[model samples]
Target chain A: MRAELFLQYLVSGLIYGSIYAAVAIGFNIIYNATGIINFAQGEFAMLGGMIASSLASRLPLALAMAAAVAATTLVGIGMERAFLRRIARGGVLKMIIATIGLSIAIREIALLIWGESVRTLPFFSGTEVSSVGIAGAHFSPQVFWVLGVTALVVAALTAFFKLTLIGKAMRGCSANREGASLCGIDPDLMVTLAFGLSAAIGAIAGCAVAPLTQTHYAIGTGLGIKGFTVAAFGGLGNSLAAVGAGLILGMLESFSIIVVPEAYKDVVSIVVLLAVLFAKPSGIFGSRAAGALKDY
Target chain B: MLKARNLEAGYGPLRVLKGLSLHVAPGEIVAIIGANGAGKSTLLGSLAGLVRPTSGSVTLRGEDVTGSRPERMLAAGCSLVPEGRKLFAPMTVRENLELGGYSVRRRLGRKAFEEDLAGVFELFPRLGERQGQLAGTMSGGEQQMLAIGRSLMSRPELIMLDEPSMGLAPLVIKQIFSAISALRSRGKTVLVVEQNAKAILKIASRGYVMETGSLVLEGTGQELLANRDVQRAYLGKEYSSIADEREGR
Candidate 1:
């Protein structure tokens, strides 16, 4: 492949990977806090994009984006408050099933509201498909938005987890819930906050990518599956590794086009996931028992 | 300072604590010692509000705190250094100490919180030396100290320790008991529930023995130490000899 084409594929791959990273981060948050893979995570993104697309037509763009994020955050908090909280004391297996049920409910609700058509979000920067030339390769300004948003969110979350009291409390709970509880930190409240934060992050991912992939009710399932694969590949609890694994997955999918047909992109992703599961089930950076969430 | 009245609690259809009652006055070091499956830990869990009681009440400093959840119990001036020192293993010791003051920080502000941290560091200077180390990576002795120090960070008027000497060396167990003894001087009431009756009863102002979920015996530390039945059941020949020497006979 020519350098320009190679670079173009690489840029788009980074954009896609950034979106996947945000989604996987959402997975990591809920999984770390509650020890359950939130199957409804991807739907939060889809809901955010769908909400933004519809609201943008009536309201100003920024307001629509804010509303979309706020609404999705409530949905995330609601998932924890209404369902997960009730079954939280149950086994992790039960909570996983609950999330699966929640995912279906959320997707169907979006379908009823948005109809079956794909929706578009106006680019945050401009209407024109403007490109920025880096070296010999050209990329859209939305590429920058996707990458920038992902970077900003990741940095902010890193700071929050490391520096803030509540954030540290959340980490403490994830490490040992009984220990955290003894310290007067309510693990349930931390888990609920995790749900809210994860939802907002997923929504942000959807909003960033809507201008590129377009928004649709069915968009979440595919992305959710891929995002989950990324999370598993990075080792479930680690956030930085999840993003790194996401980028690598995106690159693999993008570069495989050189050898295989473009229609078989998901085939490449599936193959990679299988290889990771077989060779290193804990993901590249995860501890051997990374997937094990202890009920403390 | 702390009281549990007719407490009944258990796990899923198998009750462990059966109508047990206990009390600790202010500035006292009290120990509850029992054999395995005697519900010693359950009694502490009931007192700390970690396990909800089927009946009866837990009160700290005159306020009923029965079944009030662990956080509320801590808020009500009671802290539990749980069994096995359930520290946040991945976090730094400093973080563990800070989290111990979670409710304290919220209610007492940073200045008081920091003072409490200083007090803990003073109590266990080793924790001060290894503030940045992971709690799990520390030695068993250090971990026990950190657990006790963490509980102290809450600045609770009453501190309850569940099996603080469970897996520690003899010297470490001695150090822990001495620390418990010092708490009485520092104006903090302590409740230590342990299987290591000999060591705990050494520092305890008063002691209770539990058997199959009920308080089988209660008396002053010396009285219990002198009780032949207590000596045969919980204390061995070595401890009995030491008690006899201390009594000058």
Candidate 2:
């Protein structure tokens, strides 16, 4: 029975952790390209969840999820083209302020569209799907979906950056923008593409976790903060590090319930975030150069 | 052929190139020698479209390409090797070369790209051997060769090199100069900006001396090498003037 309890907490923590890692990956994509923190990142995920939930009521689950992710990706590209790219050369402070404003605007739009009510999405494989047992504890198949999706996304991203010509150019820009520009790769286009891909990743996470977490106009605020914390914890610009940090964070949150009241989980998380940041300002796996939040 | 007429450009309020004009005809090696901060790199940069001239016109093969963006300039067949041999250090040498040929590869097919890659490898056999090696791990001379080799991957009509001799030893500089001469033999128009005046003059067909954001003198390599002012400022006091071999005297 004790072993079952341990497995439940551990497996559940890892599932939640993978979700956080997905969000962190979103933050990393734009950050790597432009060194912008992209405070609007969480909103992409929020939009994904809310949009998918609403669409699933009328459309098939697969199609709805696809549309939601695609719509969110377009929104991400629009954000870059309509605003971020215009102000890209205007220094980091300006970009930060602009993204904060955009985040607030997006949140308000969400509130207007979805209203204040929390909404639920139907389980992708259905709620009645049998759960696998570990000792006496049961683990849902949804957990596997989340973990599997995260692995697939990671694999896809690695190949995209390594194998594709456009992806290689994006990496070249990230490594040295001037060198990339000289090679006839436009930095602006690469940045816009980065935001689009980032949004798609965020939306995938949002859609994946919506059935588990439920969606609300206000859920983004907490998730955004947590994702940012994970990104910082991993050391900004290092996407792989972000995953490790997110997993550790999710596990820490899950295990903390053993000592603290479940209601105090948010407080525990905030405390841990502060403690980890104070101890290693660069996060656990961040290199000294990447420790600085913005390269510019 | 490339031509710059009365180019004036600079950063913010500080002007660097004040009415600087020069040209590199087809298949010629033109060297610009100047002291540090005299705007040698800026001149090359402006020509390469990395820096926009406040007022001037740049003509590449008789097409007015003034104030064009670097990517457009590169696509139009001009490439700058840039100062400091800035290789994408973490990437492999082949990756660097591929990126160098990005515009050409996009325009021409992969077959043309492969052929260009073969030519670049032929020029620098050492680079071919270390195609998979991380560029950052290479020696300074190897990096310079890779930088030049990378530029050659573009198969550019006019190739501008900035400070290729900045950090290399004598033997490496000799090898680099030989490569520059070899580039001329292959009909690539070359513009070299260097602080190593004496060495650069040896292979350059024509040369210019820049001082305080302006070209103070323009002459054939032999003439500039014999100029008293150039000798005093750049080439040491030991350089004997070629005055006795003066053409029209």
Task: List the candidates' TM-scores in order.
Answer: 0.96, 0.94
Per-residue CA lDDT of model 2 for A133-209, tens digit only, reads 76888877777888888889988998998887788888778877888888888989999999999999999998888
For residue B203, give model 1's deviation from the true position in Å: 1.1
Task: Please give, for residues A1-296, the per-residue lDDT of candidate 1 as tens digits.
Answer: 79899998998788888888899999999998988999988999999899999999999988999999999999999999999889877889999999999999999988898889999899988665688889888777988989999999999999999888899999999989888999999988999899999999999999989998898998999889889989988988789998899999899889889999999998887887788899988788887443342333
TM-score of chain A of each: 0.96, 0.94
lDDT of candidate model 1 versus the reference = 0.89
Candidate 2 achieves a global lDDT of 0.87
Name the weakest run of 10 consecutive residues (lDDT summed) in model 1 chain B.
Answer: B237-246
Error of 1 at A288 (Å): 3.5
> Candidate 1: how large is its RMSD?
2.3
Candidate 2 chain B weakest ten by summed lDDT: B238-247
Q: Top model by lDDT, which number?
A: 1
TM-score of 1: 0.96
Per-residue error for B56 in candidate 1, Å, reads: 1.8
DockQ of each: 0.64, 0.50
